[model samples]
Target: MSNESSVAAEQGTAPAAGASHNHNPSPNHTVSKDTRRRVVTASFIGNFVEWFDYAVYGYLAGVISTVFFPESDRQTALLATFGVFAISFFVRPLGGFIWGHIGDRLGRKQALSLSIVLMSVATFCIALIPGYATIGVMAPILLLLVRVVQGFSAAGEYAGASAFLVEYATANRRGLYAAVVPASTAAGLLLGSLLAALLSSVLTAEQLNEWGWRLPFLLAAPMGLIGRYIRTKLEDTPAFRELAEKDDGVKAPALAMFRTYRKQLIIATGAVLLNAVGFYVILSYMPTYLSEELGFGATESFLATTIALASYIGFIFLTGIASDKFGRKRMLITASVLFILLTVPAFMLLDTRNFLVIVLVQILLGGMLTLNDGTLPSFLAELFPTKVRYTGFAVSFNLSNALFGGTAPFMATLLIGMTASKLAPGWYLVAAAVVSLIAVLFAAETSKKPLLQD
Candidate 1:
C-alpha cells in the first residue's frame, strides 16, 4: 500500500471524515507496532533517568547547600548552591552542538547511548564526593565539576528523545507519541519528590545533610546503565537511517542549521522560553520556593510539588491528544496566555501558606504547564527537516534552557532578595509567557503536517 493509504488505515475514520493527509511517503508510516512500543519505552526510560537526577538535585538543594558550601549565612549558602546549578547550564549550548552533530551525522541512538553513560557516571560521582567539612573548598569544586558534566550530557536528551519518538511515530499520531517524553520527565520528578519527601520526614537535618542526599545520586549509576542498555539495543531512528542512506549525512549539522534554518532556530529558541521558565519555576523550583521563601515545612513543600507532579503527568497526555486534534500553536498559545493571566494570582495563593491551598495552586500551575510541555516535543520535531532536525531541536532547546530555564531558581531567589517582592517569580514567569506567546504566534502550525524530509 502507498504511504497515504497506510496513514489512512492507521488513523481509520478520522482521515476519512475530511482530515488532511500529507502526500509524501514518510518512513514513519512503516514502523512496526512492536518497534514503536520499544521506541516509546527507550525514549521514555532514558529521559526518565536523566531528569530524575535533576529532580533530586533541585528538590534537595537546601541540604546540598550546607553539605558543599563553606559555613556561611544560610541564604548565602543556598545562593552558592543555586549558583553551581546555573553555572553548569552554561555548558549546555556547547553540548548541544557536539551532540547534535553526533545525532545528526552518526545516529540518535549513538548520541543517546553515550550521553546517558556520561550523565549517570557524573551523577554517581556526586554520591562519593566528600563534604565541606572533609575537603573544605575542594568539596564545592568537585560538585561544580560533576554538575558541568551533567549539564553537558543532558543537552542532547530531550531533543534526541523527541526526535526518536517523532521519527518513529505514525504521521497522524506524532503528538500523542511525543507526549511520552514530557510524561516520562514528570514521572522522574514525581519519584524524586516522593523520595525527597520521605527522606525529609524521617531523617534528621544533620543526617540528611551528612548522608541522605547521597542516596538518590547513587541510584543514578544503575539507572543510567539500564537506560543506556535499552537505548543501545534499539536501532537508530528511521528518519536518521533514511538520511544516512540518502548521502553520508550532514558533515556539519550546526553550521548547516545556522545557514539554512536560522529562522526556525530563532522561533524554536524563543518558543522554548515559556517552557524553560515554567518547568524550572513551576515544577523544579517550587519546593524550594515554598519552603525557603514561604517558610513552609520541608516535607509539606515537597508534598505540594509531589501532588502537582502527579496531576501534571495525567494532564500531559491529554494535552498531547488535544494538540493532535486541534493544533500545536493553539495549545501553546493557550498555555502562554493562561500563565500571563494566572501566574501572579497563583503565587499570591501560595503566600497564603495554607497547605491545602498551596497544593491546589501548584496543581493549577502544573496543569497550565502541561499544554506547553506536552506539545513542545512534537512542535519542535516538526520545525526542521530530517537533515537538521536533531541539531535544530537540540541547539534551540538547550540555548533557551541554558539562558533561562536552568537559571530560573537562581533568578527567582535573587529577584525576591533584590526586589523584596515575593511575587517576583510570578512576574518573571509572566514575562517569559509574553515572550513565548509572541514567538509562537509567528510559528507555523505543524500538527497535521508530515514530518519534513530532505
Candidate 2:
C-alpha cells in the first residue's frame, strides 16, 4: 500500500490502488480480468446510450423534416433539419470547456454522471415535442432547443468516458479497452438503424412520419436511466484519483491547455479530424446519402447501414488490438492512405444501387473508420499529462467534431448540390483523411508509453 503510493510518486502520480471509495480495492490495483470487464462495461454503457440518442436523430432526419418543416420546399426542409443537426455540434465546444473544467478540477466521475442525465432528459423530450402540424414555427424552435441540450451533453460524454475508460484500464491493455467506447458508438448507431429499418418496413409512410420516428427517441429514457445508474454506482477512474490525492490537478485546464500544450492540442485536434468526419459522415450521414442521392429507398438504406455498423463494431475491436501490436501511427496513416486511394472507387461502386454492393461498400468504409477511431481516444489520452488530460482530450476532440464532424452531412449534401456529383462527397472524405494522415505521420508512436506520461 505504502509501496504503491511510493511507486505512484516515482512515476509522478501513477494510478493509485483505487480511489478513496469504500468498494473493494481489487478493482483498482492489479485489476483482475473480471474487474476489468466489469469496470469497462460500466463506463461503456453511458457512451453507448449517448451515441444512440445522437444517431436516432440523424437516422430519422427524413421523417423529422416532414414533421418539423412541412411548409418548406423539400430541399429547404432537408437543409433546415440537417442545419439544426449541425447546430447541436456547434454548441459542443461550450460543453467541452465546461465539462472539461469539472473533470480536471473536480473529478471524472462528476463530469461523467451529470452528462448522461442531461442527455436522457433532452433526448426524451424530443419525442414529446409537437410537429409543425400542432405548433407551427414553434415546432422547429423546440426541436432545436432539445438538440442544443443533446450537443452540450454529448461533448462531455465521449471525451469524459474515454478518459474514464483509459484511466481505469491496465496500462498495456488501454487500447483494447478504450476501443469499447467507439464499438459502443457503432452498436448504438446500428441499433438506431435497425429500428429505423423495422419502422420503415412495418409502418406506412404516413404512419412513420406521424409516429414511428418518435419510438427510437422514446427509448432514450430507459437507456439513459440504465447508463446513469452504471456510471453512478462505479468509483472514479484511478488516473484522476491519483491526481486528486496528490492535489496535482490544474485550476483552469482549458486555459492552461492553450498556453502550455498548444502544440499537442493542435496535433491531437488534427488527428481527431480523421475520426470526427470519417466516422460521423460514413455512419450518421450515409443513410440520408443512400436514400436521397443514391436512390436506395428508406428501408434498404437503413438495413444496409445497420449491417455495416454491426460489422463496424466488430472491426473496431480488431483494429484496437492491432493498434496495440502494430502501433497507432501505422493504422492511422494507413487508414488515410487507403481512403485517398479508395474513396472515389468506393463512391462509384455505391452508385450501382445493388443492395449487396451497397452493403459491401458501407462495410469497407466502416472498417476504414474503425482503423482510426478505435485507437483515437486512448491515443489522445496518452498525449497529455494528467493535469490537463481531460481538457486536452475534450477541447481537441470536441472542437474537431464540432467543426468537422458536425458539419459533415450538411457539407456532403451541399457539395452534391453544388457540384451535382456523388463523387464530391468522397473527395471530401479523402480530404479529411489526408489531413489526419499528415498529422499522424509526423507524430511519434505512443503505444508502449505509460498513461499521461507526456
Best by TM-score: 1
For 1-454, candidate 1 gives per-residue lDDT tens digits of 5454353343221233443333243455466899899999999999999999867889999999989988898788888998999999999999999999999988989999999999999999999999999989999999999999999999999999999898888777999999999999999999999999999999999899889989999999999999998998998877677667657366889988887677788889999999999999999999999999999999999999999999999999999999999999999999999999999998999999999999999999999999999999999988877777889999999999999999999999999999999999999999999999998987877877676564
- Candidate lDDT scores, in order, read 0.89, 0.84
lDDT of candidate 2? 0.84
Span of ten consecutive residues with least summed lDDT in model 1? 7-16
RMSD for each model, in Å, please?
5.4, 4.8
Candidate 2 per-residue C-alpha lDDT over 53-75 given as tens digits, one digit per residue, 9 for 90 to 100: 98899999889999998776776
Which residue pairs of candidate 2 clash?
Answer: none
TM-score of 1: 0.94
For model 1, what is the alpha-carbon lDDT of residue 448?
75
The candidate maximizing lDDT is: 1
| Clashing pairs counted in every model | 0, 0
Candidate 2 regions with alpha-carbon error over 4 angstroms: 1-30
